[model samples]
Target chain A: MNAAYVNVSTPHADRNISGIRLAHNRLKVAVFVFLLAFLVTAARTVELGVRSGAVEQSLALDIVVEPVQYGRADILDRNGEILATSLPSTLLQADRFKVQDPVVAARQLVEILPHLSYEKIHSQLVGKKGYVELARQLTPNQKWAINALGNPAFEFLEDEERIYPHGRLASHVLGFVDVDGKGRRGIEGFLDYRLSQTDQTQDAIRLSLDIRVQYALTYELRAAMNAFQAKGAAGLVMDVNTGEVLAMVSLPDFDPAEIKSTVEGARFNRAAQGVYELGSTFKTFTLANALDQGTIDLTDSFDATKPLRVGRFSIRDDHPKNRILTVPEIYTYSSNIGSAQIALEIGKERQQEFLGSLGLLERPSIELTAVGVPQLPPTWGKAATMTVAYGHGIAVSPLQLSTGIAAMVNGGRLVPATLIHNSEGWQEGKRVIKPSTSRKIRQLMRMVVTKGTGRYANAVGYRVGGKTGTANISVVGGYDRKAKISSFVGVFPMDDPQYVVFALLDQPKGTKKTFGFSGGGWVAAPVVKSVIARTAPLLGVAPKKEDASLYETVSLMIEE
Target chain B: MRRMVTGLAVITAMASGAAVLQLKLAVQDKTDNVRKIVQDIQVDERAIRLLEAELAYQTSPNRLQEQSNRFLALMAPKASQVLADPSSIPERPAGARVDSSIDLTVALEPEVKKPTKKRLYKRKGAQL
Candidate 1:
């Protein structure tokens, strides 16, 4: 407010103003730097928080949702029964560095596990600088006992033990696994990669086999085997409509758990793997072919009064009706001469083609590793054709025979056999013959059961129809007459066929109860009868009341 | 404006750091818990698998057949024994009372406790 304060353009005042301006700019710069630092710090904190949180979340998810890994998946029956599984076990190890006293530990370990040699364990415990595996596949009880010893040096590593709970019941089907958990035979060998795969969660593989039906088949076959003193036996039951195998039994089967110690012969799967001359069962195929090709009618006659000689072969009937036999009578009485004459009429080409269409010449298209290839004759000439007509000179597995019969009787459809359960039911197969021809085949088969060699297979109220076959086992030079293969293949509820049951006995000897007769009619037919009687109710097939009129025309044809 | 902005940035940084620390600790604790729970689940699953295997072994058809032979004496129902149609079963006698609690099945059971033939003969002789 005074004259001196109002002085302008003075040097001192100018200096003071300049210095204040400089200081003010410096203060602004400082504040800006601090703000930038704070912003950078905040951004870094947010980035770190997000990144760490993401990593932790993924870690948690990985641990929480990861699927458990069992060494192998289970094999189940259609009803969800466990046939084979893997049990948890451990491998015993010794940390050599941590072990204070190797001798004492080895002695104690051997005491707990007698199977482990004390010298091997002692050497291993003292041999290495690191860990040493002393034993593999220790049971839980052994692991617990080892833990009780309270030695920090002892380590129980995780392992798995494969077990078959059914023992020898389905040995041929499930097969046995090796010590390293690899499938070695049967279905297990066929589906090895599928069963042991670990990419995703694995579920049990269900088969088409009904365990109850399997038991019934095995029981009856075993009883017959024992009663008739058979050297080997094989049997199977199949769904005629879908071609699904319900049960398969091969006698002298080894337990899958103790497979290493069993005899090699017992390990052979006879039902699906052994090619034998299946005898007169092939007559059904011959007659069915003749009917399908319009070569012969039901009323046509074949001269079966004497042995039919073709080339070097003399074909005769086992149950001979020495007269001119009708088409149905040839099949009913299992006349080899009639079958050969019919085959001659059909010729070699047509007979071979017909059997091929029925899936008899090729190996069975089943899910088994041991499927036997059919041993066909070298040349389809006259003698070969005649013998092949009666199921000689060409050997085939029982499974192939059953399949051929199924096609003949199951409305002429040739469905390939399968062991896997089809959730979608009743797949249609390729038609092989006319439905009329199939009907005639069924009628003839029923006649066999009612009035011919298959009379023993007539289960009460079931109306079983079947054919009998008794073939002498073929040797290096010729057939061994003493060693015969007696077989019977039956279809039940002949009015509407549902299942095909087959039984075969290799070299069965006579018994007192069988009237010293080891023929298919005496030994194998009764087995089929028992199997049908037991399995009909389990299959939910009701017992149908007998309708006599259904067979009246056939009875007239036979009686006339 | 600069001072206010600085104050806000500092507060955000401190708050984010504190929150990150808390989150990390909680995650660490939860991870341990998850691992333990996963281990427990694995143990339970293994036990369940073992028990299922055991049950299957115990109830195998062969074992069951042996058990039936030894103690149960039960037999599979025959085809004739299975009547598919309910109408095929005979009706109760005429004038029979409709008593829901009266178990008619008891009368159908075989007389297991019936006297032996020798005892019956002795009783008849005594009566005579």
Candidate 2:
């Protein structure tokens, strides 16, 4: 019956019968072969799919890898100076296995990269790590030289390199990055997560630091440090208007580019980390605190005939007088006795509260990962109050002092210092004292700078006003008499206070101009003077040709 | 004649199927070549950029100054003879008065006289 059906074709019944038997056997074989192949393929695919989550994740990761390399962002200063940027740099790699002779390859590599270590690179190339990163950053010339070698396995990842063009200018504030390009200090450390990602590259890291002002301050301070043969130095410039840090420097500063070789001393950010017993400068705070508490008036007289005897310590000025000086005179001369009397009037509780109000008892509000806890007296008693009144017993960072001074003098408003520049009118300043009190403090500070210890800090057209502080360095074995920190804190155009500048020298050995005295007037005041003079023009604050009306009260207070 | 028609149909279908498979493979090959070419072009463009930058750097005024500083170790210029050419300063005022005391001519001081190779270069010491 099957033969007859196959033969139903008109070709030939006999031929069809033979062909049908052969076709049936071939059809069964073909069906069985296709089924077997399909089953094998399905089973193999299922096994591989179930085995590795790592493999699955890698496949997914490949899809999103472009954004990581192409989309890093920019860093701008407060006034739009390009502080940091992700510039395109070349990478150099080698085919170690293809290298016929390791010695010859290493020699050639060293010829191009003069500083490259052969042993280190050779090991990295031959290491178990699949992808070896030989040199992440390559100079344009170096890349050209490398490509000339022409090996197929030498892969270059056209990656983004973080470049700081300013070069060791604001090392402490700018901080540094690791091999993987991460910020380690200052604003870099503070805004690490923001800076590391690809999307945030378009948005800049706006810092309060003005490069022009920073250059001026650091340059002058460094020169002063060298001239005076000082052990160390630190300085800060803050906007009394917004508590913005225009410049902050702590020497010796290490280069942020090659951060690996930095010394411990160079790494310490003296402006925010090293606390000092701020000498007569504290009198500004003491007097302000007393005024704020209504404990004493500006014209009120204090007994300064002799140094005040408190336990074993005596509150005596560097230049004492046997007279009942008026409150202004006491602060102008920085008389410790008068400061103590004013502190006593305010009482320990009120004094403590006032200092605390100024934020002197806390760490400075700065964008730094590292800082020092202000060493406050355990018991804020009568002696503690008296000592603190003159800036002796307690210790605080330069940054804290700068901000505190700004708060006291800038219309009594305390604007917390930030590394990031705030938009116009964005800072809602906290008013710590009355405007009148602030004006009064400004006048008093001006008096100190013009007629008192900070005589050297007077910048002619700038109408500079400030106070000088020479604190004895507190050491483990009593206080280091030889080692003293001389510092000057200044405010320009005190009539309408705009900036607070602080200059300090660590263990300054007196210079020829100083006439062999390392006091604040000799060492630190001149630094402030030179810095303010240089920075004023760069900061867009032209030499004060016309005195603004806002400084009328301050001018009136100090004119006499 | 019927068997011949059946054989012709099978051969035509197989040939057409093979041609489709080959077209797909050819398209895939073209795409891969294009991708490789793109990557190569990127590498070449980067190389070109690096070379351009290097050329600019080698001829930079700063580089000239550095080279001058290096070679001048052998023959130091006289202090009084040094004069900073006012024209060299880009944004400086036309009547810019430079104090005579400044040793600006200690290094490369291109003069008003141009297009001459009267090389006033300081000879360098023995190579390190």
Candidate 3:
């Protein structure tokens, strides 16, 4: 068959050979392409395998890393104590169409969560609506227990609930959030935007408040308030140099956890919001203002032998000293006559400017939304000047008084009162008064505590110096002598003032222990003394023996 | 040589296909593991937050004060009790020794003697 085919196809051999060669070339090309594709795939596989180890390790690590959603950043104290936080909660919802037995499910739910009323659950379950909320703020354990019931209709929506673990502690500062997680009051209201901003990496908001110090202040203030039978009370502790409010308490404070239980009166932040003629505490500012302006020297004398007559009003001291009182004597005796005379010496324009520079003639610039504007006199006449010098005509918040006093003692620098912790050390405040003036004021304040009306506020070794202000509450057309605002503004370690503690009792009644006197020395000074003694050590203010030179600088020799 | 090359190519193709399949399975397993671990971590984080809140609530100052008043009869420290300087603290009495170890069983024992129960009696002066 081969010989016959060869003989017949000799002429076509060339064409057959050419076709065969073409087919062979095509096969070679196909083999080459197949080999090339396989090699490329193999190389890719090897490369992927080599990188897979890193990818595997990352995958394993990813399992342990989970994003934490706080919803709102936590509010923490200076010591990192959690003041306010958010906890994960589940809101249980049910589809009415899918529920097998509404009555049974409701009964079961009420059994698991006794806080939810059976009636409310039943109504929600059997409602005509397609979907209904069964319960909210359910814990993980509760969610699991409910899920075990195998009800497809039931669904859980993950949510967070803001919780204040400290209850009423620092409630006025930390404030409370509304149902929709909107900040409503205090720091919550002031820095709500920053707190609610969606940045999980952001750290908790650290406030200047120290819980330990707050506890001490609150305990003492409450005790004093109860003992005096006062209508309300407020207290604040602030860093003199940094202007950081360590502790601020305004009673009758309400629990932030239960917003509905809070009364309207209880919600008032007395320290920063309530404006009052803070009585004798104003005398410190008056004396400091005079000293700062160099209008009055420490040896300057004023006759307090008789009540000073100014138009229809007569400015008199509660504890009358029928003699010529020097500048130190006036401060120590809390002589209204002396303070008024000093105010006259300073003049109206200078007094207003001085007070304005100290941030007392305007609204206190704090982080709280609830701040009171100073109720200045309609006209700055002689009577208004005299009355304001004794802390009666002009009304300012306790925060302003503390801030002004802080400026006077803290080397005459006007440090703005701040609720946020200043992590960048002591802020450089604008110079409000001369350093020498501040030093003289400190000496005078120390003398007041050592020998005058503020003696009760003297803490041993702490060298507490302060002034007492007990002003009659102004009523329509007249002042009610019985209802007085007793307050004390105290600075401790007077040689170098670090903190200012201001405490006040509104409409405090006289008690037997107080010798039937609702004066600041009797009612408020003791609170300041107690707070200082307790918190000074905690604040790390080392106590030293009173230096003889320091006493001599502020001491005044009274003539008979 | 051609036959040998074909044989080698087939083996290489088979091995590479198996390796790719194995790698795909391993990747799937790792991904599932990572996903599971992430879920677990989330659960744990939630639990930790809840615990922290509960702990804070339990240890709140007000509640502690109330408990101390009721159980321990503890009172707040007075200003006089707070000495300004540690050096001002009076020296301990002679022969007094510091004991570091706290015996809970002994410490837990009541400090005060329990009051005796009063006997019930009928009084002729008092009318029921």
Best by DockQ: 1
Question: If scored against the real structure, what TM-score would every candidate get?
Answer: 0.83, 0.71, 0.86
- Interface RMSD of candidate number 1: 2.0
Off by over 4 Å in 3: A1-17, A36-66, A94-112, A117-130, A141-154, A558-560, B1-16, B63-128
Clashing pairs in 2: A73-A201, A208-A419, A495-A551
- What's the DockQ of model 1? 0.42
User: Best by lDDT, which number?
Assistant: 1
How does residue A315 of candidate 2 score in lDDT? 73
TM-score per candidate for chain A alone: 0.86, 0.83, 0.91
What is the DockQ ranking, best to worst?
A: 1, 3, 2
lDDT string, candidate 2, A1-560, tens digits:
66657547765776777787799889989978976985786587577667887775564412211222333345566877666666576776665566556566666777888788989877766666655667768877888877797755466777666666666677788887777777788777777888777676657678888876777677788889999899889999988887788888999998777788888789898988899998888888888877876888876788889878988877777877678888888878888898888888888877777778878888766788887779997787889888888888799999888888888888888888877787773455887888878877888887777677788998766778888999999888567888899999999867777889999999999867778899898899998988777666556454544354544443344323
Worst 10 residues of 3 chain A by lDDT: A57-66
| Superposed model 2: Cα runs more than 4 Å off | A1-71, A122-131, A545-560, B1-128
Interface C-alpha root-mean-square deviation, candidates in order: 2.0, 11.4, 3.2
Pitting candidate 1 against candidate 3, the one with the higher TM-score is 3
- Measured by C-alpha RMSD in angstroms, how accurate is candidate 2? 12.1
Local accuracy of candidate 3 as per-residue lDDT tens digits, A396-444? 9989889889998999898999998988868779998889888888888
